[model samples]
Target: MTSSLRYWKKNNLTYVLHIPPHPIPKSPQASPSKTHVPLRPVSPLQNRTDIVVDHTKWGKILGRIGSESIHIPKVLSKADVHTLTAYIAYLTSSGHPREVKELLWALFPELNTSKYPSNSEEHSHRALGRKGLLTTYRRAIFLGPVFLSAVLNALYKSNQPILADRIWTLAKKAERLSWARKLLPNVKPWIMGPHAYTVMINCYSSLARRQYWRMVLRPQRLNYRTAIASVWGTLRYKCQILPRPLPSHQVMELMHDLMRHAALVVFRRFMNLRHDYAEIPEMRRWLAEKDIPKPDARFFNAALRAFRPRTPPMRKSWYRRQLRDAKFNLDFKGVLPNSNDGWNGSLHEVAKNMIHAGFPLPPGLQPLFVGRLRGFDLPVVHGPDRGPFAYRPQKIHPWLRYRLHTPKEKGLPVSRAYPQFREVLAQRRRHRRSRKRQRNRRAEQDAQRVAPKVLSL
Candidate 1:
């Protein structure tokens, strides 16, 4: 539940808007963990007719609520909260971006709940005392990792970035309550775990990818793609801090399993020249670890793409063999055929470069790029009869390639996520400094203005 407190000076009143948590719905990629939400079976009649009718009816109902302040005659109960969550999930999944804002508006972003008892078993309709509400600094957080991750996923799939951004912003801001003194509890689950941040990152990556394909014939905007990379990088560094952040490919698999699309992040990493050197070995070791969960073949396929000139022949052959033998990867999950890479074989000449560069190729694969593959190659994927980029591969620049080795602690070998992790620290430092400057400037201006008042007094 996302609950917030607001003080209204007009009537000397404060309201705590408490939105309760909803049970997780069944999804195609729904985790094996049991969900509180019950499965509702749909017959063909309901699926084709009833669902459409209900979806349309709700769409109309939501549309009618334009900018109007809604009044709940009664305090929302657990049942009410579940209903709201279910409706939101249903509407969101139905692709009804139309009046979703109105639906969101109905979420009680500004509910007056101060007079009610905080510890009350029920959401009381009657107003109560103020002192109790004012004295207590702690706020209840009902938004769990499970709920938030699901909600974020639904919002993104529904093309509700604005709502998604607002949720993310709220979750991020909950880190610090600048207005009040107390810290929030259990906030990390909302923002960090469950790929909540990754959902948004994947959204940006998807957009960037669409732009790349749209501009294949024309001169693509390099800076635009660079900006997208920077944004996702900053978020990964700032918002997500796993003691052991999974490598980019694992993150990519999580995305594919969740969203059913190939994430460009994996491709971008594969195309990085230095990626094969630093990241591939780390993946190999990670897979070899007995403690880690059984390796997914999709993950193995991703590693195969990381092969480059510097990669040892033996290791390359071994990776190919691992991919070839299905038994090695254990039980395979997710969409059967290459949905992770959107079922596309070519990206920035990776397939082509690997073949021509003397790297072992998995069965029935060929090179798609010509010349020296380096520095940000735009994927020129086409239908059947596909050829290489016909020129040398243009890979993303290796600015971070010139690194001085610094030894680290024992566990979890430093993989590709290290640079972004480092950047994230610097990014936080820069943010703090920037904020300090703004705060000081505001304070100085206030002092300067107050100086004349002091002199006059």
Candidate 2:
């Protein structure tokens, strides 16, 4: 027993052998055991790679994707409308009255306003008042049954003639004629000078309506005096009045009827006169009949000499010996003067005939005779080539080579003489300096690469 106990203690045999087994108990179903699965650790290098990809390339892709989703709305808010309205109002109130009216009309079409609305009596009075047409605000407002009393009160109270004139001028530019006419009467007294009356008549004349002219002439209706008075006034002021005066009513009517015929006759006479000067015999006869004074002897001789053809007179046998020692050709032959007699008559005679006939030389020839006489050289340039040195010299600087080749020749530096050359040298030096700096940088980089860094503990 003792040995068995010792053996049990030594080997734990009893606990191992103490299995209680009886009748082979049925085996229970085996249960599965739970097992723990360890998680894999993320690498620091992998996190760095992800950040680099996002920062370098993927970040751009994400940004573009986000930007594509953005949208902007398109509607003008109340502030925008107010701003536009203020700008338009400011532009309208500042001397651009016509444009202001136009813009207002465009904005409010229901105003039933025409730029010149003759049908509206209130508008007509306003237009007239603005143009300074009425003789007085009271006359415009009260005298005329079709006037706007309230508007006249406002315009008359303002009583600014200069401003009214400016507005009237603007109205004229806008073709508000009826309105412009309204201002005529009131401004007439202020504009009593010649310029004023002329402008008034011109305004009526430009209408091209005979009725308007008659209206202006009639003292009863338009209040302008007689046509003669109008002309006298114009002359007093040194102004040119049109519709030239006629000697009689009969002549005026006759001229009016024959205007076209008169023009045709005048044109035909002008053309015929232009052709008459070309015929030499006819020109001389006309000059002789006119009894014109002759030109001075010197002038006549100069002109005659110009017309005479050069006959190589120096080359004649007698002159040959005289000029033989000279270094010029003395050739002579059967050369004779040209027989043209066109310029023989005195210029004075020609001029008198031209004056009597109410014609002058064609404008082209007038300048020839009236201007410089440089072109009046003796028409016939004769004689041989005159001298050995007839032609001008060709070689300009023959001494330049000798000066350049001299032994003591000191050369000027190109940069000293030419500023452009100095600039070029400066640019070249800068380029060399840049290259040297780049080379130094590369050498430093190489040295750093070859050198070793000591590790700190």
Candidate 3:
């Protein structure tokens, strides 16, 4: 018998069976051949002494990259360690911009450096360290708008308006106007400009559209939309509190300019097909309340360009409106198509050049311009079509062109008598027959079950 095999005594039977040693053997001093070996513990903490804790090299690298003031765990739990390992392993997996701020909050709740007062002089200056601190910082640009506002104030106090403007641009891109509204007072005359106001109005309109879409899709989440409304209200209230807020007329002028220059941003949600013609009255009423005038043909044309042709009737109505608007004089805004050169050029400059070059009037202009152009017999300038300035045609593959252009008759093989085709037809016929029989049987059984009993009674 092998040395590892041993016999165990029971009642006095002559049978033999192999037996293993005790799970925890005696000490080495007690037995030279066998020594005690530690068994697996029921609780993880029971074997805590056996486990070694160390900072992950990559985690250390990330720590150096992220904000030093922001806390990152030195020793992670098993779950956190597993999560960190997975995050590292699948490094290419991406998160949406909307979730970035939430992720920062989830990872580190104490990342409120912006909440500190700016008047702290030296201590505040030290806390405000390098801009690179936020480059890899766990927090997102949107959530750091307050931090940006504070930084903008500091930049302005230090006579760095250009840097402050750059920061404002970044905050605008992140769509954090709620935080940005706080900086408007300090920024002063710059924020009162038409361009800045246009951007702000566009931001509000975008938020309104987003909230409106959410409210439509989820009636139960109405509170979220309400909260967005409250935020807007808060913004307006803040403007009122400003020592020198832009006048109400200036606000109206800003809206008018935005409607003329960037109508798509203002009217898309209100005018799109997802909203019905029945809502037009409501829209008009709302516009009147907001002191926004009815849009001209140019504005409608810009707005309609953004609409998908998914609904033919609504799209047809939009085209009709565009035609009606074109009956008046055309005073176009923004860049004309087909010429990238004229974008930076002023309206007067473009008109002067067109007069000098004798180029035909651009489309989407009023009928009067068209009439004048037709009468002049000017050379037609075949520039890009007038529509949404951002629209670009998607490139299609040559190989897939056949699939798109192929006729129904050509889609299927002409060889219908092939074995595979025959098999398919045979299966379909069998399925049809089976279905008919099942229906007939069910009918007969149901009729019999429903029939009255006469003689049996």
TM-score against truth, every candidate: 0.27, 0.14, 0.24
What total of clashing residue pairs does each candidate reach? 15, 5, 1
Better of 2 and 3 by lDDT: 3
lDDT per residue, candidate 2, 1-457, as tens digits?
Answer: 0111000123422211222223422556644343344333323342232222233465556534532465677885554334544554445335333444454334324323234332334976567444443223323222221112111122223433222323323222322222233434342211111222222222222222222111122122211222222322322222222343323443333323232232223223333433443343452233342333222222222222322223343323433332242212212433222224122233333333333433323221222232222222123222333324434433321222001111111333222447887888999999999999999999999878667552221
Model 2, residue 230: what's the lDDT? 30
Cand. 3 Cα-lDDT: 0.35
Cα lDDT of model 1 by residue, 222-326, tens digit = 233222333332333332333545455545544333322234343343344233333434532322323322222233243333322222334445544534443
Question: Mind giving the per-residue lDDT tens digits that candidate 3 earns over 369-426?
Answer: 3323332224444434343435443332112200111112222334446889889999
What local lDDT does model 2 show for residue 330? 19
TM-score of candidate 1 to 2 decimals: 0.27
Candidate 1 stretches greater than 4 Å from native: 1-83, 97-99, 106-140, 172-198, 212-457
| Highest lDDT scorer | 1
Q: Model 2: number of clashes?
A: 5
Evaluated at residue 363, the lDDT of candidate 1 is 28
